[model samples]
Target: KGYGSGGKVTHANVFIGSLAEGTSEATLKDAFSPYGMIKSCYVRNKGDQTYGFCEFNTVSEAEAAIAGMAGKNDWVVKFANNDAWDDEVPHSNVYIGNMTEGTTEASLRATCGTYGTVESCTVKTDTETGKNYGFVKFSTQAAASRAIAALNGNDGWTVKAANNDTGGGGGKGWGGKGGWSDGWVWQPGPSTRNDDSRPEGPPSDNLYVKDLPPGITEDEVFAAFSKVGQVVDCYVLRWDNLSACAALVRMASTEQATRAKSQLSGTIHESCFGPISVKNQEKNGEKLEDHVYVKGIHCTTSEDQLRSIFGKYGTVMWCRILPLPFRAGAGSSSVPDVAALVQFASPEEATTAISAMDGKVATEFGAPMVVRFAEEKANAKRPAPTPNNNLYVKGWPVGFPEFLLQSEFQKCGNVVRLRLLDNPDPEYPTCAALVQMSRVEEATMAVTALHGRPLQVPLPPMRVKFAGKDQGADNSNLYVTSLPRTMTESQIRQSFSKFGEIERLKLLTQQGKPETHALVQLSSPQAAAAAIRELDGSTPAFKG
Candidate 1:
């Protein structure tokens, strides 16, 4: 049937595409008014580009537009079931580029009307160039996808599917140009591929060991591989610590790491300190390559403790107890410390040591030691900040919502106010928030606790102080507003406990003689400072 001419429009949703630059919601409604009553039309902008979405009165009108202009040039139309609207909808938006100067929202909707129902359209002009590059959002993903498939890689104007909220594509740009590429050329960047093996030639490098314990040094590494062939080179990877010395023994050929796998794997070298195992490096015929690292250590703790902890996990290549670093201040520094690095014959062993003991306190040291993958150091200049204070937190659990900040800080003291910073644009949200405490001590405590913690929202790790005319000395006495009417004093107290001790709390109410917002007082300035650093301007109460 003709567009919206049949019985009451069946589809409440419709998609619009092939919009010209500078279209707007009012113009879109006027353009589509002839078919039937139009609902809301939404046109949005991306930088200088225009994009958006719109709703219609009937499904039949939507379907008619789709069928009539599925592959039409300049503009295309399609429809999607209302249920398809979600974070994952594909090709629901279009980007319009290369518009003439002085283009406005009305002009854009008229241009797009030639295709089908004109949803909201807008033409955004770059202030610097005074050029138009905007976007149009369709009511249905199907329409947007149809437009993109038809117009992509065509000609004059470049059109591609808009990146969806959940990150999908829309139609290609005008003239059917500017689309994604599917070619393969490797440079330097993150790779999604798992296997990276070359078809021809031997593997690049072989393994070698040297500087073993003088007594069993040579025989130690070779005895295990006697069946394979003669050992090529045997030495130790030396460092200042003699006890932590590592042995590198090269097999006659790369094949030895695989051929002597069984015997060399379990053979233990008897050293002054303890026994070490030998093992193959890799498997032949397999295209994959691998590397190894070793670590194991003991101090006053017995060798049995080391073996019991690390032995069952993986094959141990070598173990030694290196002397501790020399003290700096003359005679006072003369105390022995226990340090060791164990090299596993295979990477699996090294990984096991790291996984199991890397952070464990093997001896009676203060904190757990760190273990990580070693790599060559490249001297590259650090990146400059992108005009914003973005902080990165490391230890917090993922997906923690922003609301939890108040609860986290409640342990220390009373929170007077909290608010998350508002981004200038809704499409581009920011990560940082602001917090205020009743006491400086509470704020300080929060600052300390949240200093290295990951923000629930994405942001850099640094905390920004509250902006005020004075800008000096902490403001501990403060209040928060817009709290949910259901909130109680006990909940407020609990929320601020992490910051410090709360002196008192007063919830604002219209019934009270003195109309005031919620007020909280803390015991010390430290707590107040902590609260201010971590909880300011992020909560609903202080969002305004």
Candidate 2:
């Protein structure tokens, strides 16, 4: 049924196109009911066309109907657009590619017309290449989004918004979750970097140049590299407070890249850099591998925190933190800082993260972090300590209502504590939470039942597992570092004193370093955990 302007759609609704002749509401229900519990089903007529919608008990059910009905019996199934009925919203024009041979404008219009009013449709052939492409303009943005959602990546046809200005295909101006914007879909440029796992064609002839002095520009880099080969592109990547920077120079061919790398390796560009290292970008090898090794991690840091931090580079597949007492090797137990291995979807993303986060001394991270390529299983990981009552849950998008976590975890057992982990990078959408259950059995139940279970519609399944041994209930001591040498012991106590009584606060400083490390023991484990919660990554106000 058509919705008036400003009408909202629920996530559990599925839109059905090309309803069969003489089909009734009962027919739609009968077709979809096998997939899930159907809340409502109806067939509606607009003008001379007939369509239908089926509302299931949950979004998963609706998706099940789409998957089961799609490509069977010529059924066109997609999520119903909440804004589909609104005529006042901005309309969209789509760019369609990879059309089959001899496809006509009439056939294209017929396909898109099933989703919404096709205001105009056109097919064109590249005179020079004979490649056929087309465009479909819908009366409303919602209609175009629906058409793109159903047709994109289907039968080899690629459909997407013609431009970002249009309110279609996950662009701005779409009011709410509807059509293609509801779940993960395609967009363009850096904003859509979340799904870098998709094949992006073959590797290019790129060269990685490092040790360039600060303030190097793309033109400067191009001028230096172009002398040896035809330069396709150059990018100087930098971050705040960085002493030296790096650049990526793309040559026209791999042979040119090889020649340049062989000749320019360890050579200095007199104008812009010191003894620069020029190597084939792909040769760095890290750019082709997806795992990154992170060290100097604060003991209090969570895996979700690392995921969110590394996510700024690309989508993180998973983050595994090896808490103290859990080291790369048995002999490395003396290593004080925590360590983690984060895996991203793409090697390029992992490389980008290493470039950005390696030796990064940010306050939020609690210390300067060491990031680098992780050789396959570089650090042997031990299974998390079992019989653990604390659970670490992940797989929810950022900005999810954290308050809902307490109530949600209560379903399994008594929640002693619930803390939603922080994401320092605002742009990253993945988040995690830490839940302290009253009993080990309840935590096990949570892991068994909630792992891979969908808690919220349209969001990915929640990943629940036991946390590291250091995060267990019996731990009341905090291994804190990165404190200013002059900060004094009383100051450290005062900063965390509000949480509880400080039983012992010892500050240690190395001979040459400007920072000091501290070992804080509170009156109770609850007080220590509370102190970490409040001060883990924050700079508290300390008066002189």
Candidate 3:
């Protein structure tokens, strides 16, 4: 009879005991499916092994399952803990890993919750190291089961239904051991929350706001919200089809974000023209802002002149002039834009500056500074294929799928991993793929034999080559140049901090070099990949 916290009781869970060593969750679900409506079912794991448990929509369905399965299968199964949903359901947490650099918790919950009700989610982080892992808890066993079935080992992540082990984090266990200890975390707060107060959402530290008037610049928006807390990053998006703009802002902490959203939503700020809607930042279609990208300056425009024209709004961090392509190691090309980037103290300032200067002509250049935000990592240019046992292939048959590719690659050797990417580059976009062979020799062989080979009739020859490696032998250390002269080591470090932990970042000067060079060391290779992939061939303005 003990069903819910107080009154709401919709289902009863069943426990299947003495399961065979190899028994899986699908076997249990099928055994009980014919009896009645199944809510959730899973094989409980002691340590890397599955026992058995399942849930039915009601006591009647559970009874039917118990009566039908008794004396039939070679297993002992019944309601878990004698039908204790409260005791067992809280432990439905799962561990998710292999997230890409810059994966946010809001993104994880939004994606993982598609399978079921996510009761709680904890992203474990190593504060000292800047590495992250995650634990997600679903309300029912079915939710956990569905997620594990669908998301595990997909998208570079390893997903598994957490066990009662110390690492797995049992019923009392929160996030995995030694992780999330005073780390950034989120949890649903008090249920008795009032409507006028901070609104309820999956508790997160970031906030998103929409319906910002065009006239209210990014700096003004930042200044208004800075009243509540320090804004980490703010990106304002304006779609050509939409009349009004929207913004996403990350706060210093979850509590500050929640408080500001509750207080600011439905209220018009002093400089704003309309009521701005404030809520938790969603993972769906979200973008991160580092610096504003600017173009359309006259070739003669100088950084000091541009800064003077734009310095009225806020603190001008640094002004960088985009270098023209050099010719024969002597004179540079006659490019129209020396595109001076006016870096502001914060993204909010950059937002306002772009909103104001994008269409407005520069005072000295006699042309408008085509100010715009840079493309985010996802939308940014894709890296050429990597040279791990992985091979990059393009111009494959249009309709041929991944399984077909895997089958063919197995002929040469074992196909460890294979993926095809949608062409995103505007100039040379096409169907592209990456395949990791079982061994380096196998990769070499596949490249040798498969280069220019035909996969299907009437299609372009399959182009198989080793993906070009990053300019550096390893991306862990990045060599950079053309940085503004005013940028200090701290400024350079701060500019690259979003990618990951910086082990060491410093400036190197050489006698023959036209500009100073910077070398950056990231804690992990993944972080380096993220930096190089997002920033190669692109210029970013850093503030002092």
The TM-score values for the models, in the order shown, are 0.24, 0.20, 0.24
1 against 2, candidate with superior TM-score: 1
By lDDT, rank the candidates, best first: 2, 3, 1
Instruction: Give the top-scoring candidate (lDDT).
Output: 2
Clashes of 2: 2
Task: State the displacement of the C-alpha of residue 178, model 3, in Å, after optimal TM-score superposition.
Answer: 29
User: Model 3 over residues 209-249: C-alpha lDDT tens digits?
Assistant: 65343222344456556777766556555321112335666
lDDT of 2 by residue, 132-176 (tens): 999886644556666776789988998987753232233221111
Q: Poorest 10 consecutive residues of model 2 by lDDT?
A: 326-335
* Candidate 1: tens digits of C-alpha lDDT, residues 76-141: 445533423332323345776666666677876665543334445667777887767767655444
Cα displacement (Å) at residue 415, model 1: 2.6
RMSD of each: 26.5, 25.9, 27.0
Go through the candidates in order and give each one's C-alpha lDDT.
0.41, 0.56, 0.51
